[model samples]
Target: MPSNDSLARASGNVKWWKNANIFQIWPASYKDSNGDGIGDIQGIISTLDYIKALGVNTIWISPMYDSPQIDMGYDISDYESVYPPYGTLDDMDQLIKGCHDRGMKLLLDLVINHTSDQHKWFQESRSSKTNPKRDWYIWRPAKYDADGNRQPPNNWMSCFSECAWTWDEHTQEYYLHLFCVEQPDLNWTNEECRREIYRSAMEFWLEKGVDGFRVDTVNMYSKPMDFPDAPIVDPLSKYQPAGTLYCNGPEMHKYLREMAAILARYDAMTVGELPLTPNTKDVLDYVSLKDPQLSMVFQFDLVDIGRGPVDMMKLTGYKLSALKAIINKWQTFIEGNDGWTTVFSENHDQGRSVSRFASDAPEHATNSAKLLAMLNTTLTGTMFIYQGQEIGMTNVPKDWPIEEYLDVGSINYMKLIKEKLEATGASEEEKAKAVHEALLNINAVGRDNARTPVQWDSSPHAGFTTGKPWMRVNDNYKKINAAAQINDPDSVLSFWKRMIGLRTKHSSLFTFGSFHLLEPENEQTFSYVKKSAEGDEKALVVLNFTDQAQEFKLPTEDGANWSLLQGTQPVEDPTSAPLKAYEGRVFVNFGARD
Candidate 1:
């Protein structure tokens, strides 16, 4: 059992991020100021007022570092400089100042897990085996099989559907790349390399006045020393899923502590992206208040509810019961153990929340979006809103072909599927059917769905760029966009503003509250209560997860008079009325509880 003291300490000494409402901006799709078909820092600066009006106090911009664009800036070639397509250092400085001027802090995306092979460090590292920088990255000698053919160091698959180790002809050894071949994993075991990362990747930004970082793949900094082969998950595939071999290795904690010490000196906020964190106990080791390694972690249990273990493309129908279980597990365990986690349903890597978790049809999209907003705001953790989520963005149209997809993971997965089908000696008709199904899956769960240009207006390219856009804008932008919804009282954007304002007004109850789920077994409805640690403020959030109306009985206590704080549909008496289709409501019961 965990002690209550952790919760007490968390509530006592409040951090800035604990009460923050963060909004994520993917630069390439946000706004293209110069009409270059790519978003830039100047464009972000121009939109500060708009973001501030949404009641968000923090802005987390995705990677804008100089890169080859192979992984959309995740493969950084330079750490200290901004990508030329985005803007220059002067523009970044101005953007920082602009955010601060409007009372908003800025968080940059930190991609220290790997660097582009084009990076000077990696170039020097692969120059010669005796080079001083040779040990800066993971390198292992190739293995020989029974035959004369050479093999990679281990039978590990990359996240993008290929061998994890890439052969280097010049170095005569294979280098590790958990993602694309261009993105080489760094060696955190090297003290000098770690120090360089602290200076160039972290200290440089902090000194430049940025508030903090959204650490990419933070738990994967350490790797297993033995470099052993992973268990065969798919017999047809030559490589295997090896996340267990590298994720949360022995030195992971030491590396995080070292990074945390640097962040503490500047009082910087950090939210780590933990892809495969096993449980809440493991998450606590990184975010525990006793000796904080990170301010919070983005756990994937909620987003990964219906997805496959090794291949995310193998998705199944999402169940409300499973969602409820995940919520109960994380909310209760983290709250009890005094750990912190982020509350978000969408990001650059995920499809639109409305399309995934709720109905995205024309009739139910608005209400469903509002329902998600209410649920997210009333949760007991820091909130994060992805770009285009406020106006209820949906996934790409089903008619879109594979050519429109720009995400490396999506493209690679499609190729993998095609090859597998070919290997089965299937007929052309069967192969075509498989390809069509794969495209449908990509349309539903692909990263490109969220990477489309932000729908600013009904103009060409949604006013994101004057020139041809980097990717196609959502076709539904004509009816759903920021310009059209900014002032509409009944619009999804307005609902988000109101919900965010409500959370801001009662930060204590929503941020550090004790969460209690109501009717956890109910499949069509999700309801939960949040009570402040001081036992004063209380809020009840009820949501209809289905498209049809559902009856819900509110939890009533003596001397409690529940009043509507916000709702998707008007209800005179929530306890008695049936919840409308895709409806959501937040009710507050003021005064002491018996």
Candidate 2:
């Protein structure tokens, strides 16, 4: 179904990753082959064919390492082994082979920013001040008052716990943990520690035929040499949280260069989760081909658009046009520098895109999901589709009991907010109302929304497991499951297939084209033009971000001789037509007909 011209243009793409889209999977929720109630590597191996059929040539699997599950699998206890619930090292080897057999690359989550307290390195480091591994993690002597009451070495706070410094009575010192107290921060300043961390963990995977890594907290590896006190930004905050001083630290680039050199030893690709990447300059410096520090980096500014701190109830009132402007800046910046960026709407750590950014109305959810797919794919980057995204997955039920939620961050946030409200001396009735509002907001933005088991079919447990599922499946699975949509030509699943086909047939147009936003003032519509770098081909992509009928008029200079290339709604005319709610289309420009 691909046009010959589009295929011809696509064949010009140079980098394999530039032309290939990626599929992201959260293993615990993907599928369970064994009766263990947890999705494992074997479950992923079983779905490799389905993923390949989706037209994606890469898979970014979230962490499956040995862990305490305190932070899911991010709190790694053994970098060289798999979590018992997930599978064994042999299962991982089979997964690598499965991906390779399908001509797809596999990227494991590399979470080296911290390790669980159960890790051997941390255990030995905490054993004694004279231990050889004592300096493997950040440890400092505790400060004491004249009365002999000990205080934390610094004012820094943990991202999950209220306090960052956890005391180790045996050593009589405190260790730093940017996240949970169980996951202590590694001392990247230690040369021996860095070598062991990389050689033992990373090299082990690469030698086993693993492709690369989706480096977690990639920019937070370095900390400022001087552990200075953070300026108090919130008077009522329980503890001072200072990530700005350490995130993207002075030595981060140097570390990245070293890491990149090591990665270059294998045939692989690296995309980093740069949580603190500030601007265009940082992006260019990290991913520019001239320096070649990384394949790409994930920028999170768009995901936090409307949410307040820690998924609070406060809303930012962000508009669609504002999102267009922000994306345009990054796209233009990357395209100009010969660097690359990634395009995605939802991942393991965030809520579903359809429910948060687009309409989740029963009447319009499918179309909105399709619109988001069109917007993300037509942009100039390698696209990543999360599981269930191809089938229009909705958020969990808003009234889900707090006890059913499993994300530690969300649980901690709930407790933090409830405590804050009670501290205000408000009446119980007022406090209850405030707490209810916060819970609703959490239901909207919580990570649990994306962590629910994949809705494979309408069978019990949504066909994810014959045994009990780790989490509850969405009640709408009966109507929205993959079994119901895969056969329907008009379903979200079919639309995603069509989108990926267009991407492959016109890879050059997406990989090297210059992106320009059209009608940046349009509040309800997102429209853009992508012209091939050599000016031989050009296309227009228009998407209705809202669930309401709308019309769009291209600039007169664009000319009216356009032909429809792909569309979510039936095309009546190429240049002018009434678009249904959440409708979108990609059109190719023909020279002006005099």
| Candidate 1 lDDT by residue in tens digits, 262-376 | 9999999999999888677888998998877999988888887788877778887767988988988877777556577779999999989999999889999888899998888
Task: Give candidate 2 misplaced runs (Cα > 4 Å).
Answer: 1-13, 145-148, 309-314, 553-556, 590-594
lDDT of 2 by residue, 1-594 (tens): 333333333454346667668899999999999967899999999989888888889998999999999988999999998999899998998899999988999988888999999999999999899998999999988888799989887787677637888888888888989999899999999999999988977888889987888888888888886688777766667577677777888888888888888888896778898875668897888888779788888888777778765433345568888788888987777643457778888999888899988888899899889999888878877788899998999899887888878998788878887777778788889888987877787788888999999999999988999998888888888888988888899999999998888877776666556688988988988888887655666788888887777876545674555678888877667467767898898887644222
- Local distance difference test, per candidate? 0.89, 0.83
Steric clashes per prediction? 0, 0
Worst 10 residues of 1 by lDDT: 1-10
Model 1 clash number: 0
